[model samples]
Target: MTSHWPQPPTFRAPIQPRQAGARNGRFELALSRHGARTHIGRQYVSYPFHMTRPFAFDVAIPSLLTVYQQSSSGGLYRDDRLDSRIDVGAGAAGHITTQAATVVHDCHGQPAHQTTEIVLEEGAFLALTPDPLVLFPGAACSSVIQARLAPGTVLLLSDAFALHDPEGRGRPFERLEAKVDIRDAGGRLLVRDNLEIGGAHLSSAGSPIGDWKVVSNFMLVGAPDRLPTADELAVLGRPERQVVGITLLPNGAGWGVRCLAADAIAARVIAEKLFVLAVSAAFGQQPAPRRK
Candidate 1:
């Protein structure tokens, strides 16, 4: 019998865009005043931002306003996978949104994972307002965001997810897990939200861990003395479609809002509206519009 040789260990990789220009396996978006220049794979993307002060330009490709889908997958964890990360430095202000909904096809055999990490420096403003992340049947994915903020900076962030049938029939059972950790410049955890949803944990006839159709977490960080008032709470807590709760932090780090909805779109829309209200309240004015 012939001897079998052991195979070498190989590092799992991120999904490459169908087009070109990508950096470090992700559609790298380095914060810039004139929006962000996207790197498809190795080549620099052609799209450029318009530019808005107080609000820097954002980078998303295949942008909804521009290109199509960025990458294609073979299946799931087996081969085809979509993964990305964005790094925002101090004094940067911008919003990162996807061109459209991010849909993950069912992996017949292997589960796929999509991950994003956004790191913000002091005095930075980030609004991650992309479309909902849709997971088809048999899609298994996990995402994480590690945000490091400065003393006087403001961070506006949210995460939304949904699961539907890959065959286009209707909704199917799926598992979506997400985690967000906001830490100070010193690497201390200021706030943490961990959400895990799946067949077992999701309530059907008698489950208890989760019973809502969709769930989301929205966070805003600013100076403590400049918090929202009772009137502001009345306006924010008044969503006709979903249940939302807003609470101020005792340590002055910021405020937290958690909402659960029956659909992902509703969750996203609420998150954006809440962000706008929270920012306006925190800054004493309408936040700057995102530039090119």
Candidate 2:
């Protein structure tokens, strides 16, 4: 395990007979520029993980690759230790999104753990915008997303989650522990965001999420020229049940966004809007629509 990843509690998983980094469930992807377009240079995928063939559908940015990640298992299970990694070689550009939202089912008495690692070499660009995690009642999860970026690289990463009780019992998830860590290629830490919330606390008196059902954070790390301008961001107006906060990142690396939505649909709009705006600013043209 890396120094930043906290150790997981011991438990038994009946689904996969392996730990993280083992051959059973871990998936890894590496991409690099091949001539004028980016291609998957290396890949290894195991059970529960699959991906579509790379597509260069964006006419405005024909060289950029797009992929949809998929999970075959219906949902997360108790004591699941899933690991995934992606590497963007120098000068490669790509966008990756999930086929749909992931459901974090009840973990029984053990917590499910997931770790994601992303590395971007110089001049590489990557955008990762996945649907939110739907936390079911009694769901306990620990999620860590770590990124290492070299100089001249650009990254747009978003994370979001929402609560759901399939039985309509009004029960919330047991616990959710999430962390996002970003570092430079030299191993210097850039930013770290940590959040731990219990499901019960979400329903107490005067809850912050009184009406909102989803919360998300979107981060952009890149040169100023590649960031979104104030004018292009005007589309993010004050909606009826939405709240957003935007701030510049350290050393002007880029900007960060925190948004709250009444539902998952609203959160998706915010993420998609920001991606389009930033892409236009960086590449000088709006990308062709990526239909959901």
Candidate 3:
């Protein structure tokens, strides 16, 4: 044995097999409308706005979502996954929904990543108000949203999150990385937001981007010429359990309303209120309620 070659590093297999949840996934939604248009501003500029038109798309399943995974028998496995993309074309309007909250299993050995892409054509409008994506105690994940808007399209975007312990007590952990990239028809970068939260970033002294509680962001685009005023924002009157901020984006001259809340419901409630106030002031028309 003394003269034998090295023992290939004791070749011991992993103490436990990787989790069976190691699966790839994708969900896609496309949009196109038949007929609809709304006038833009007092300058007499008019653009096609279809709030009720729906888009055309194909889904492998009957529902608006899809998933893949294998239950872990040993309870010590890692899952690798992705949430494909949602594409919207010019003159398309559609609503995409997930049957249940998207969950990222505990990353015993690897991290989970998801990406979302959205596109709008000239004179198009798209609203993303999907149900909140929930994360488990030990799970890890990241999501990204990229949108390309045509010359004069309007957009309403929002996101919400909530976390609790087994006893229903508010318990928050984990990290969140959110970024938004908006581009013009010529592919020019308009504005980008890079937001990160988790770990030591939860302290009150952390950068203004995040704190120890849940956070929500809502962006609304009106006619290229109309921008909401401070008086319009005052209509919100400060929501409970939230610190709200409002501003007009330098890019596309869009208006944005942001909030940090204690839970998902609170965040959504605050977001809806802002949506109503802004939509009315900007377009002089009330937006429809989001369908579950």
Among the numbered candidates, top lDDT falls to: 2
Residue pair clashes in candidate 2: none
Q: What TM-score against the true fold does each predicted structure earn?
A: 0.66, 0.89, 0.66
The worst-scoring run of ten residues by lDDT in candidate 1 lies at 60-69
Question: Least accurate stretch of 10 residues (summed lDDT) in model 2?
Answer: 1-10
Mind giving the per-residue lDDT tens digits that candidate 3 earns over 1-292? 0112112222222456545646555545454444442221111101110122232322221111111111222221244545545455555433343333344445643555556677767655555655454655554456677777776566667765544344454333355456677777777877676655552233335434344255566667635643456676656524557777776676554766766775666666676676566445534555565533
User: Native-vs-model 3 lDDT?
Assistant: 0.51
* Predicted candidate 2 versus true structure: per-residue lDDT over 1-292, tens digit per residue: 0112222343333464444432236879899997888899999887788887888878768658888878988777767778989999998988888889999988776777889999999888899888898999988888899999998888998888898888887887877788888899998888777777777777556556777888888888876777787556655735786788777777666777888897877888888888888677767888877867
lDDT of 1 at 145: 69
List RMSD in Å for every model shown: 10.5, 4.7, 13.3
Per-residue CA lDDT of candidate 1, range 217-291, in tens? 666666554445546655653355667777664356676776767666567557667755655654455543332
* Better by lDDT, candidate 2 or 1: 2
How many angstroms is residue 239 displaced in model 3 relative to the true structure, after the best TM-score fit? 4.7
State which candidate has the highest TM-score.
Answer: 2
Relative to the unseen true structure, what is the C-alpha lDDT of residue 289 in candidate 3, on a scale of 0 to 100? 58
Q: Candidate 2, after superposition: displacement of residue 264 in Å?
A: 1.9
Error of 1 at 208 (Å): 5.6
- Which segments of model 2 are wrong by more than 4 Å? 1-24
Report the alpha-carbon TM-score of model 3 versus the true structure: 0.66
Q: What is the lDDT of residue 102 in candidate 3?
A: 49
